[model samples]
Target: MEIPNRGKNIMKTLCLAIVLGGLALSSALQAQPSEDTVSVPVSARQLRIDLPDAYSKMWPEDYRDLVANYSLSNGQTLSIISRGTNMYALVDQGPPHKIVSTSRNNYVALDRQLKMEIVLGGDQGASGSVTMVVPSRSLSDGRFVPEQVVLLAFR
Candidate 1:
């Protein structure tokens, strides 16, 4: 009788801890996007959030519109598809683009046509915009150079 009672008490304590932990986690996740969701740009397919491991992990079931097929500034349309766990960008008349690097809310893609690096991320300056950086031509000293940076944001 004593042994059974002790086991029951231990089980009860464990169950209580698990329940509390779950409640705390649920609240934290809920608070993340409610404040910013309204500010997301209309053209933006999804929140400018970094996947847990660069699409190596499945997207949350609650997220919608996992794919973004849009035209780049260079007049080339790139199609990026999400297979729930990973994303690949299909370049026009070129090979599929792989993720060069990734962070919490940003990633870089290397393109062959423009032969430059593109950075996509959330814009801290704008409440509901995405930041994009592409190559640009500028006069440096006495000659033209491709070191200029251009920022295109979607509001």
Candidate 2:
């Protein structure tokens, strides 16, 4: 009789433990982001950026009509089109932009968008990261203010 009661108590305890564990897992799953889209505020649309795969894959496949035109610090213009792993850029209808110089983590790109004299810095261990900056004329100072909108990370 005592052995039977002991077995019944063990089963009850095991059942309660399983229920509690399931509840914990349910809460954790609810906290994770959904597979389709990330949670972003409506007001942050300008700050919204598509994933790398979107730029590398979807842009080439579907959104190839979207052209990025950048007014360089110089007098020329830079036109960029997203293809695959490599981004193609044409400088004032000139030849394809090539890597002029490279450092351990930084590169000095001699293109119209990335002016030859400008030095771009990045976070530690960052490579091939491109950030889109939206420039607006300041009403107070009458100067161009650059606000970073989207950042795309590439290996």
lDDT of each: 0.39, 0.38
- State the lDDT at 62 in candidate 2: 39
lDDT of 1 by residue, 73-141 (tens): 334445556555555555444455544334433444443221112334435321111222222333225
- For model 1, give the 10-residue run with minimal summed lDDT: 125-134
Model 1: residue 78 alpha-carbon error in angstroms: 1.7
Q: Which digits, one per residue and each the tens of the lDDT, describe model 2 over residues 24-139?
A: 55765665587664544455324332222211123344323323554442233455555453445554454554222233322222442331222223243212443332223243
Best by TM-score: 1
Clashing pairs in 1: 55-85
Deviating ranges (above 4 Å) for candidate 1: 1-66, 109-155
What TM-score quantifies how close candidate 2 is to the native fold?
A: 0.23
lDDT of 1 at 120: 44
> Global lDDT for candidate 1?
0.39
Q: In model 2, where do residues sit more than 4 Å from their true spots? A: 1-67, 98-155
